[model samples]
Target: MTADSLPPWLRQPLAELLRQRGHAWLLQGPSGLGQYELGLALAAAWLCEQPEEAKAQGACGHCPSCHAIQVRTHADLCVLMPEVAMQALGWPLDEKSQADIDDKKRKPSREIRVEAMRDAIGFAQRTSARGRGKAVLIYPAERMNNITANALLKTLEEPVGEVRFVLASEAAWQLLPTIRSRCLGFTLPWPDSGQAQDWLVGQGVPAADAPGLLRAAGGRPSDALRLASQGQSPKAWSLLPKAMSRGEVGALSEHAPAQAIGALQKLCHDLMAVDCGALPRFFEPADLPPAPPRAALARWSRSLASAAKTAEHPFNAGLMLEALVSEARTTLNSASRRP
Candidate 1:
């Protein structure tokens, strides 16, 4: 995105990070804190031909290097994301990998494959194709399985030419300490509330609705924008508590099984908070129904967690969702037996 369109909060950090020097970096923070965006910008700036200009104001958005990146055609950039993520980001897979996926030879791997890691290691060793140095941007680095991570560890430990690494993660603790020790670490900064709200408004979220969405996202602006983009609105979200309490499945029916379960999990979370006399974080307190019995909430929490483990590979999505919502209904409608 152009500097004009970049979120206000990310501007300074992006600029500051670009000015620093490092062959490898670990950008870690909780989900929705812009780790991926920051990592991409840092990589682009590194590969940008206009170093002086990019250093001052992030990537020069219109340069050939920047344009190549925007199109996912940058010769010197290797983005090592999960196959699913690579597909989502419009990054093309290697020809053989693409053919395999196209022919349904195997399912798209959710974990970065060892094969991809080996290719990246080779890429890192090659001379920079664009005269600028090479960069490997791995987002949600936690997704690397142990075997794949081990393959990348050697390259991370020792420098090979001008190749650079930017590993961005929401769950940094999942990484091997040895892998982490090889890179400089930068924790992402949380944006100020006012700044986030303003940026949300600028991104087409209604000004009045921004605060509620922002709160629903637990102050994560990227998540708030995603919620809005996915047809969620503040009003609809506020109605979720009461909807779940009444066993109304419609509030969550439109979402995929995983997403629906996630919303229910949040509702369960808030109900637990209300039971403990604490204000809710993801929903407006006044909009919530009376809290469920602690026993029921706990039971449902365990069940939801179990379901989350297999939510991605459900045998029958409709049945799975029905079962999940039914379980939620039982817990939400239960009452405390305590005097």
Candidate 2:
């Protein structure tokens, strides 16, 4: 996509980043804040063929370089992501890797492979295929395991030729300190609620569902859009807290174990907030049951956190969800007996 096509909240940041001079940049923040989008936009601006004046606004959408990126065929741009992310984002994998997976030799990797990093290092040393420079974009940079990160260290520290790098991550704290030390760090900004809501409507979310979805995502617009795309209705989200209190497993039955646990965690968080005489962040006060005792809520919160560690590989999703709901019911019922 063109740089101008990025979300409104990211445009100003794009311009700001373009004006800076850095061989390597680290764009970091929580998920759903467009770290990947901004990184790609910056890459495009660096490689854009447009005049300097037009480049300041971001990439010229009509340029050949921009089109190459749009179609994922830019010879000078190397994107490092998990195989799953590369496939989902429509970036073509190297022929060897694609053929291996096609032949069922092995499953696609979830982490950045060292082999890919080695290839990228070689690419960085090559002359620019186009008149402009080269770029390497790495998303979820934390996905790089130690071996892969180490492979990239030398190249990042003392780059050769006219190449630039942008590493975007949702969990920058997980990255190697050396990797973080080599790049200019930029944190993505959080858009205000009104701007987020308007953008959601622009993305075709029903205006009526915007507020509830926004709350469901903890005010992350990209997450809100994702929730809408997943068929999570605003009404169902609003009912989730009370449904858990009543021990209704079916309310969360459709979700994977990890997602179900996350929803429960948000519910637990809101209950704790209300117990402490503060407004809830994920659910409306009226939608929540009466506040449970702080001790009970705290216990439930700890359990949820522990469960989250293994939520991705539950022994039995059915049993796990039932137990989670049962505990929620017990904690929520404590509110009635608090007197």
Candidate 3:
């Protein structure tokens, strides 16, 4: 879906700023959080030939170029995704042709590739298609390796025309410091869990259980809405509470890291709220698992938060899983012992 269609919380802040100030930008956010969609939206707004105010106000959504750009067919707007170079071999994917390339094993090309960057740079060097603005969008901008990144850097540092670069990335931290420093970025906040649950229900998640689905989806409305739309979320929701109470260390390690952490993150949120006496809850008070004995909850919360901070490390997965499970076991055991 296009970023324009996304809820306001999910829209990029820099897109709004660019409209106000007339500038280029970099967009960064978590994976599956729609950074690329935001980039495309920014490009469409930049390239529309209508009055600058109309173009900047919003993609007219009805303009011919807006329609084409929305669907990614605009001639002047360039989009560079990772290149799947099947032609280098004797095989390529086609609608009628079957190939042995394992789709599941496919990875984003290690880099956007120097050739694609060069072409985009060259396109930007030319005059605009409508004698106004030209736009180049690069996805996972951080994926541009040293050579490709350097080539793009030269153009960005000294562009020859009324060109704008809108780059998108899930891992902005991987970008060269120089490149990142030059670009303005918008940090999109994940929607709060209740808003996410409401969004899931709106997408046809059963009203009775959307909260659990929101928790399992990591409080990201887009994530929650997608699971509900596909009917895959209920099963995950069903598994989550049980996992919280009993899905020990070994089981957590075996399950998806994101799935396990998602549920645990919800539990942490719930516990924090309960400790602070927050009212108007998403979790049912009766169904709510009790927080750990006061001291243990504090200790476990610190450990889990620490693990969360280190979760990106290669070695942290096993340790984090064990820590979560141990914490869960402690909470459950303490609950049972209480009067």
Candidate 4:
């Protein structure tokens, strides 16, 4: 769907972006804040053959230009992303790369390859096929390694013809400062709680469950909707804090090792928040056993942060789960006791 068709929570950001002028822009924020959606909308609006007002808002979403983008056939737009991301977005790979991947010669890459950057450079120098110049959209732009990023640097330094660029990133700090310096930056805004809950209901989340789902996702509406749509039941999620407190490894059995660790990380994060006399972000405070001492929760936080680095490739998932839960039990038990 066109960006204009996204949830209403995103409309203000899209409009704010449209009002700005830039040859290149960096849209940076944590995930689920709609950087990718807003970036794509900006590109579509730039290339739209429609009237100026339409350009100043969002794509008409009905023009041939908008339809082309909808179907990924825009002649003057280039999408630079990791092969896996490209595939997921339905962007076609160059013919040779497609062949190699299809023939099992290689797997889709997780990082943007240098070859793809080279192709984009060539795309930049060409005359506009659609007479709207050209637009390059790089998503998770942090995926570009040094060589690929360096190649892109030359284009940003001296933008060719009418070419424009939008770089959307979840981790802006990981990019080269030179790259960051060449573009205007916009930080995505988090929607208000009422706005988030309303959007969640509009996305088909049960009205009664909206608050819990929203809280579980740390107030990111898109993430909350994603969890609801992905079948994360409220009851199952509500039970997590108490289960973890009891060392119930089975409480996390439904998640992959990495996902399980993320859940625990959130759990630890909320416990620390409670210890500081703040409300919990992920779980209902009453659902938690008790807040551990600040010192104990700090250690738990550090341990979980370290575990996150390699949680994806844990050598023994079962052992890791057991150890994690046992630690949880010790910490929670300590919290429940009087000095």
- The model with the greatest TM-score is 2
Whole-model Cα lDDT per candidate?
0.85, 0.92, 0.64, 0.85
Q: Write model 4 residue lDDT over 68-118, tens digit each, in one string.
A: 998999989999999998998789998999999999999998899999999
Candidate 4: give its CA RMSD in angstroms: 2.2
Q: Which residue runs of candidate 3 sit more than 4 Å off their true CA positions?
A: 1-4, 10-15, 31-33, 83-111, 190-195, 229-231, 241-339
Q: Pick the candidate with the highest lDDT.
A: 2
Predicted candidate 1 versus true structure: per-residue lDDT over 20-136, tens digit per residue: 888899999988888888889888888888857645767778889989999999999999988899998788999999999999999788888989999999999999988988999
Cα displacement (angstroms), candidate 4, residue 274, comes to 1.5
The alpha-carbon lDDT assigned to residue 336 of candidate 1 equals 41
Of candidates 4 and 2, the better by lDDT: 2
Candidate 1 Cα RMSD after full superposition onto the native fold (Å): 1.9
Off by over 4 Å in 4: 1-3, 316-319, 336-339
Q: Report backbone clashes per prediction.
A: 0, 0, 0, 0
Q: Alpha carbon lDDT of residue 84, candidate 1?
A: 90
Candidate closer to the true structure by TM-score (higher is better), 1 or 4: 1
Q: What is the lDDT, from 0 to 100, of the residue 54 in candidate 2?
A: 73
Candidate 2, which segments miss by more than 4 Å at Cα? 337-339
TM-score of each: 0.93, 0.94, 0.63, 0.91
Clashing pairs in 3: none
